[model samples]
Target: MATEPIAEDLAGICVDSHGSAIGMPQLCADWIPNQVFWLVIALVVTFFVLSRIALPRIASVLAERHGTITNDIAAAEELKRQAADAEKAYEKALADARAEAQAISQKTRDEIKAQLDEAVEAADAQIAAKTAESEKAIADIRASALENVELVAKDTAGAIVAALGGSADAATISAAVGNRMKG
Candidate 1:
């Protein structure tokens, strides 16, 4: 029962469509001239606005943006050039500093070497003097020891001869002592 009444209402809607607007208004033959005139007016007005106002403004904005990009690129290139120059200067300064450092190091080394040589020479001179003094003192001590040995030997020999009831002459003892001291 519900489907039958709905079907009747849908059929009545189609039959009553002739008394009301149903299809697209623009496709009607009775309104063709008026729609054409309004469409042409709208198209002409849109074209005029886009070409004279909106398009020119948009074009100017694009040109300004392009100019800004070009300027930025040029500025970047200039900065790069400046950076390269700074790097070169830095390298040169570093090289110069290194050279100066090397020169100073060499000078310092030479001075140290000269001082070392002078000190070595002074030390050697002092050693030579001390060695000569030591040699002279040793020679004097050996001579004094030899003289004391000779005197002690003579005294002992004289004492032994006297105890044995035989007299040994000083000259004879002296000759024997000299012969033995030769070794």
Candidate 2:
């Protein structure tokens, strides 16, 4: 059986054509330090950029949002104040209307009272006039009755004297009148 000869270069250091070592297991072991250094530099750069640029912009935006919130709160408070003022105005108007209604009611009551008083006065005057007229009529009737009584007495005395065949004297006429009055 035939086997191929091993090359010496496989176990020895390999070099590039420019005389630079191309492969070193030791250099490959040191690559971890270089990668660590570059990672630290990248982290620092990222931190500076965020602090100087992006962070400031974000802070400004947040401040603007806070200002907007404050302004909105102030506007809401103003609106609340306006609403309260409107309610107060409405209450005042309602009170005024009630007062006016009360005044009107009082005036109407006063007018009614005045009218009632006037009517009462008129009724009293009419009653007084009617009473006076009744009294006057009663007096006249009494006078007429007295005159009729006197005439009747005279007639009775004349009849009595004719029946008895004697002359009627003043004394007899007066006695007849006295008897009629007693009856």
Candidate 3:
């Protein structure tokens, strides 16, 4: 059978020399030194782990990551500079091509203009020659018509004189007709 707690046992455990409440043994001063000793040991082990192992690894990783980011940014800037240079080169080449095309166009125009001027000069020469020939032909036709008119006038005069019973003189009629036709 279990023995019941006696009065002596309860009295001895409930009251102590100090006026402190009774609870867990952790509240007692006798455990203070042992708790302090364990606390110090835990702190030393934590410092060693952080400083020698975990913190150095994290720091190295951070440093490596920063270096990678910086290198990537630097590479991007270099690529941008190269792109700008390429654009400038393209613009320069385009300008040069345009200038070359303009020069070619100007040269073609000059050559065409020279040919046109030559053609015009040749046409003018031909027109002048034809005009001179036409003028000479007109002069010849006018001279022949003047001679035919004189001969017709003489014949008419001779016929009229003979019909009036007068002497028909060819030389006299010819002389009179020539004098009238002078203007």
User: What is each predicted model's overall lDDT from 0 to 1?
Assistant: 0.85, 0.83, 0.85
Off by over 4 Å in 1: 1-59, 166-176, 179-183
RMSD of 2: 8.0
Candidate 3 residues lying further than 4 Å off, grouped into runs, are 1-29, 168-172
TM-score of each: 0.58, 0.62, 0.72
User: Count of backbone clashes for each model?
Assistant: 0, 0, 0
lDDT of 1 by residue, 136-171 (tens): 999999999989999998888888888999988999
User: How well is each residue in 4-54 modelled by candidate 3, as lDDT tens digits?
Assistant: 344453334433434334675666666679899999999999999999999
Top model number, TM-score: 3
TM-score of 1: 0.58
Residue clash pairs of candidate 1: none
Candidate 3 structure, TM-score to reference: 0.72
Where's the lowest-lDDT run of ten residues in candidate 2? 1-10
